[model samples]
Target: MKTILITGASSGLGKAIGEYLFHKGYNVFGTSRHPEKVLNSPFPLLALDLNQPETIGRCVGKVIEIAGRIDVLVNNAGVGIMGPLEEIPGDEIRKHFETNLFGPVEVMKAVIPHMRRQGAGHIVNITSIAGYTGLPFRAAYSASKGALELLSEAIRMEVRPFGIKVCNLAPGEFATDIASRRYYTELSPASAYAEVYGRTLELINQQVSGGDDPVMVAYEIEKIINTPDPKIHYKVGPFLSKFSIVLKRILPDKTYEKMLMKHYRL
Candidate 1:
């Protein structure tokens, strides 16, 4: 059985993916900040805090110690930050990048050498459709994912020679715990964006509540693992969300911006 290591597996997409793969007979090692909080998980859970980069090496070491080899590494841990770029504090922005981008990069660095030694492995980075096009009020989150998307592309080429495959899995809004987990900037009455920010936040919550089931993403991940050669970029979600990536490629910049503005009522 192929051994799989997944980060942020306490809940949401990460949890779903881990469970799916576990039932499929893969040796799955999952990570959460407090693994004990997860009730009755079939697989072993390790403690991992993406914000604390120093803990990443230890977390990866634990997985290797238990699994012997990691055939797949899923960089699925991430946090969401929502706010106007201008008003979002520097600390908040740094925190957002620390969890979403730097954390995954650190995990990648820790796992690559082992995969290289094994002669083959797959690394899946969970990004977002927002990475392809910026989202209003989610500037930091969008930017972080976008950075990961590009980084995955570059690393894909660099690691292919080592029999290591890197894929950027970009999903649109999904029915996950993201709504509750996301951090929002304080909106004061004097703030210019207060009214619109409120409306946008509500809209975002509604969309996420009604979005695709995260199990769909897990299914895609399963397929990617089974395929002999997987695409570097896999956009998973509903039709419009997946199409948005294609639309961005074909539409002029101004047109795309107008469409987004209208959709968000910004």
Candidate 2:
């Protein structure tokens, strides 16, 4: 059986992915910041707080100890932030990059040597559609994801000779605790962009309420993990978000901004 490690597996899509893969007979090593919750996992679990660089290596250690191999590493642990760019402080912006971008890169640093020795492995960085198309009030989140997508793209080439595949899983809106965790408490009590904040929050809430099922995302992830040679980028989930991304891609800058302003009712 292949061994796979997934971060942020305590709940949401990560939890669903862990459960799905374990049910499929893969030796799933799941990680969360809370070690106690590891007991709740059906598969083997380890404590891992991405903010702490050391925990990543230790988590990797756990997987290597039991399974003796890690065929896949899914960087699914991330946080979100909302509010206008000017209103959101530098510290908050850095926090998003630390958790969503650098954290995964650190894990990759720890795991790549093992993968190199094994001669083959898959690394899936779970980014977001926000990474590709900047959404209102989520500048920091989108920036972090943009950095992630770019980093993964570069790493994909660097690791090709090593027979390692680095892929991006950009999911559209999905049902998860991501909203609660991603919400920027530090940037809250919005005064500078009060109008924008309230309006964007309402739009976000509606989307979250009707988002796609977590299991659907889990299934897509499982497919990515199983494929012999998956594409460098995988886009999945809600159609509206996907359509929006395409519109942003094809339309002129002013036109796209107008559409956004109209849709956001800004």
Candidate 3:
């Protein structure tokens, strides 16, 4: 069976993908910051925390030890922050980058040499539609995803020659616990940007309730895994993504800003 390693497999979208793909006959190796939360998974588990390079390296090393070859690497582990840009603390911003952007980079870098030796592999990053278009009060979150998207683009081209393909799956809001744990909340009482922060949280609070099932995003991951040539960017879920991409393309800056303000209910 083809083996796949998925990060963020403890819950939500990553969990769904891991379960679905494992049942579909892939030897799924999964990672969880809290492995006990996913004790029920049929596939083997690894303890992975994006904050620690050692944890990432160890997990990848273990996957290789067991799976022998990693046909797929799903960089799905991520956290969310919901608050105004100015209100969020520097450490919090650093945390956002640590998980969403740098974690994937570190993990992918660790796995690439092994993939190069194997002569074939797929690296799929679970980004967000926010990567393409900015959302209200999610400045750092959006910036992190934007960086992932561009990296996926450049890296995919570079890896193709070695029988490797890198893909970015930009999910439009899916039902995931990431929305519940707004990482951008204040550190203490005397924090800055409270009003804007509240607005950002409110915007995210509203977005999560109106999304498609996490399974849909999982299925998209499955499709890409089976695809002979997946695009550098694959966006799934919501009519809103289409509208957002179009507006971003055709609308003037001020007009697009007006549309986003109204659409996001900000």
Candidate 4:
């Protein structure tokens, strides 16, 4: 059985993926900031905080100790922050990167050595559809995930010679608790962005509530793992969401920008 380690598996897409893989016969271990607090998980949970590199290393070590080898490492743990970049606190922006980008990099650093020794492994980074474009009120998330997307492309080439495969699976909005967990910058009634930002926030929430089942992502991950050679990038979501990438590629820059503005009614 291939041993899989998934981060942020306490709930949402992470939990769904972990449970799916566990029942499919893979030896799966998951990570959370507080594993002891997570009750009745199908797969065992380890303690890990993306903000802390120490926890990342320790969690990876414990997974190796238990599973002997991690055939797949899924960097799925991340936090969301929504606000006008101008008003978002600098500290919050730094904290966001710590979880979304740097922390995942640390996890990858911990696992790559062992995978190198074993001569085979897969690393899947879960990014967001918002990463593909500059979404209104999601500047931080867009920048971070976009960086990860590029980082995946770069590392995929670097790691190929080591028999390590790296790919990014960018998911569009999905039915998850991410909305509740996201950090929302204070919306001041008199602030310049209050009117548009508040409206966009509601729209974002509605999109998440109306999103596709996250199990679709799990099945897509399974397909990627089974493929002898996987692509550097894969996107899963509503047709329009995935097509937005193509639209951006083919449409004039301003045209696309206008479309987004119109969609969000900015």
* Regions of candidate 1 where Cα sits further than 4 Å from its true position: none
What is the number of residue pairs that collide in model 3?
A: 1
Q: Write the per-residue lDDT of candidate 3 for residues 1-266, one digit (tens) a residue.
A: 78899998888888899999999999999999878776588877799999999999999999888878888999999988767676678898998899999999999998888899999999999888888877777788889999999988899888889999899988887767776665755545566655545665666666677778989987888889889888888888898765688778888988998988876555
**TM agreement with the true structure for every prediction:** 0.98, 0.95, 0.93, 0.99
Q: Worst 10-residue stretch by lDDT in candidate 4?
A: 59-68
Candidate number with the higher lDDT (1 or 2): 1
Ranking by lDDT: 4, 1, 2, 3
Where does candidate 3 stray beyond 4 Å? 187-200
TM-score of 2: 0.95
Candidate with best lDDT: 4
Between prediction 3 and prediction 4, the one with superior lDDT is: 4
Residue by residue across 196-246, what tens digits does model 2's lDDT show?
678778888788768998888778888887788889888888888878878
Off by over 4 Å in 2: 185-192
Give Cα distance to truth, residue 109, candidate 2, Å: 0.7
